[model samples]
Target: MNRFAGRVVAITGTGDGQGRVAARRFAAEGALVVGADLDAAAAALTEKLVRDDGREMLSVAGVDLTDEADVVRFVGAAADRHGRIDLLYNNAAAARLGDVTHTSEADFDFTFRGVARIPWLLTKHAVPHLRAGTDPAIVNTASVSGIVGAGMVGNAPLLAAYGAAKAAVIRLSQICAVELAASGIRVNCISPGLIDTPAVAGILGTGVDDRLRGWHEEQTLVGRIGTPDDVVSAAMFLLSSDASYITGHNLVVDGGWVASGGAGRPHRDVVEALEASLAAGLRY
Candidate 1:
């Protein structure tokens, strides 16, 4: 499609999952991609995929996004190489599975440093170069958890921190969208729901794939889970001219899970109980 032809894109957390998928999708569509990640090996893999697919790309040194100097250097090098930055995908994050009471200070700090603070820092450093490019846009990866409370009855602590951090990302993107609108830059966010990614695998423990399959059927109204490609597709649309009028929008791609009115079906016990209550006419 080449929607991104002649464009320069810098994506963080391209090691795997959503970031890697986004890098690949953009590169395939004719964008010059700079893949950055904490895992050098995974970044290289993405770079190779881009090259093998006959796409324009460069594999850069990993940046410790929490480190201010490191982020500056990474963005500076990308801009220096590309002469300008057209797109910035702030897609990196860290996760810890603990409840509020069980989560430690270190866990909270780590999540904020990697997910919250890094995105802000990246935007701050990349804005100058983005301002000089064609159709500049920033796509942040928030989550369904960020939009609403995660239904993690057992893993409350970990989900709490993760959800809170993602909510902050959503709000931050909105503020950036407003502040940067006059500069011809668009800021948007993608809030994914239970996509099949490495991070989700970690959360499911053993038999993760099977668990995910079951979860998809149960939670999503579409009767299936999502893949990284689903998210990448959303990102591509938001970054393209097709979404010129969209900003400060948190698009949820959860297979109708969020829109369902809880009317799919009721369990046998609930149906039987309801029928009995109706038959007895015990209601007030």
Candidate 2:
């Protein structure tokens, strides 16, 4: 699967997790990978891992994706090196979590700005280079939370801002697809559900959330938690020639969790407890 051979791929959030996985996979598949991240050390480590794998990868560290200047620098470096960018992966997001009533103005603004604004900035700057690319494509990472209200453990609606931001991401991808269509550039997104990443595990109070994994597996028809490989595979296909005709699409890579539609949502008691907590003016 050397579909990306000789192609220049610019990806965000390559410091770790899904971004790291995607960077490695792209490098392994013969792409000239250029990556950026907010964590300097972690991004360097990702670069080292790719180089250790005997693949080509160059990474920039401490990149603030929400900043248009930073996004332009990231895109500019790639174009300056390769003369064109063959793919753009808008895969970075760092934001806050809070329910509407308690969420501060600053946190809400930062959350929406981080999750939704960066992708647009990257796409805008990368567009000029992509216009000169070979069968270029872009993949944005949204979440299943964007498709529905992101009620969490105990039915806590603590991620309302993130959900709204991701919903904007989904819409951004669609609009970009239509706007970039004349340039032969395809744009799409993958909305994943309950992926068992390190971030998710930590949120569940451990290095690994076995109980949470089991609960989601039971709910998802696939009987397992989603993995970075699952996302990378779907993303690669969208960027590949196989999906040349596809654009303006949102691929729900949730292992059928969304289709099942809250089949295993928290019990009624939990929802009631949440309602009570809210009524009491409890802060998440």
Candidate 3:
């Protein structure tokens, strides 16, 4: 659509999944994409794929997003290469599922720092360039876990830190949006639910994909798992002129899972139990 023609986009975790998808999408729409990832080879591959499609892409491999110095350098390089930053997608994150008791200090720090603090670092550096760019906007990748309590599965507390950190990201978006609105910049967050991404599959391990996928699909009102494209589309909307009036909003791209309430047998049981209570006039 060339909606981003002449614009510059800087995205993190571009090695794969939604990060790579977003990089390609923006590039195809005529933006000069700057992609950074910890996995050098994967980042290079993403650059190759986009360039092969005749799109402009600059790939920086092995980025330590949580490091302030590294984030400064990354943002500086993007601005230097393109003379401005139009969109900054804070798409990089690392997660370890464990209850607060079992989750080590290191793991908890890593998850929260990566999910929440990294975006703060990037935005702190990118805002100046964004302030001067055309239609500048920022999209942060939060999760439905942030909105809810990650109570769908038995291991809900296992992701306590991750969910809390993501909730922080949503709050960060709101704060950044209010702070940047005067500067002609918009900040928004997306809370996705059970998207079919490489990271999720990796976390699920072998031989469990089909079963988990099926469960999630049934739980989601859309009756299917979300794709990278679904997220990228929502991201593009916030970054585009169409969402000019939108800011500090958390868009739930969960296929109506959150709106519908719960999932599978547990959700049904909750409803049935509630109905039983109401029908019995047990209100005191």
Candidate 4:
């Protein structure tokens, strides 16, 4: 509690979901939060929510993470206001559900541009400022798909490009951690499973809450899926001094999905149906 007291945090993709929740959690723990996102309106909404809860926050212009100028400006503005940024939550990402062959070049570019490139850019710019701060840390949100194959969901191709990009993020964070250790900047990553977020709704083409509920109960092994708070908790731990010795670590916050190690293995009936479907060429 109050681990982040008097700290300053900058979080990208703070418009909704994990980013928004992270901002609120930091603020509640006495951190001054700067929320940034591509959607200006959504960022404003998040800002209001934090403010409504009597927390300190600042909303900045939405930055295209792929753009160097935008990232520089966002990082500069945050440092100018807060004096220093203690934590950087690189949580913005886009999802594309398709096989490697089926995924388009544009999809790959868009996903990496928003998720990987932006976070890398922000890290580059935020380094000096973070180095000047007290207990500086960076928390990147990767995914379980980055570490393991995503299972089939109604014959849909799992997130191919998205998973690859997130894997890169994990490696990037690890490299940063090793390189920046001398500078007193800790870099860590969190790999989440299925979290109930607006982006999930878009990917699944279903109502957010309904899809989340179903996935929580049936798909995840923990009898429920993750929430933004689950991720925020991991992030907070990395950013806090409690994890001072922890660096270059990838924390998986999935609901026992990755731990189970039985993701790609199908049940007997499911395997029979899949074989039958394949023999019939119905899958193709």
RMSD of each: 2.8, 7.7, 2.9, 6.3
Clashes of each: 5, 0, 1, 0
Model 4: clashing residue pairs?
none
Q: Which stretches of candidate 4 lie over 4 Å from their true place?
A: 151-155, 202-216, 262-284
Q: What lDDT score belongs to each candidate, Candidate 1 first?
A: 0.82, 0.87, 0.86, 0.82
- Give the alpha carbon lDDT tens digit for every residue of 201-226 in model 3: 74434375666556667677788778
Candidate 3: residue pairs that collide = 98-158
Regions of candidate 3 where Cα sits further than 4 Å from its true position: 202-206, 264-284
TM-score of each: 0.90, 0.89, 0.91, 0.87
Give the candidate number with the greatest TM-score.
3
- Model 1 alpha-carbon miss at residue 276, Å: 9.2
lDDT (Cα, 0-100) at 134 in candidate 1: 93
Give the per-residue lDDT digits (tens) of candidate 2, residues 17-74. Answer: 8999999999999999999998999999999999899987989788899898988899
User: Candidate 3: minimum summed lDDT over ten consecutive residues — where?
Assistant: 202-211
TM-score of 1: 0.90
By lDDT, who's the top model here? 2
Model 3: per-residue Cα lDDT at residue 221: 76
RMSD in Å for model 4: 6.3
| Cα lDDT for residue 113, candidate 3 | 86
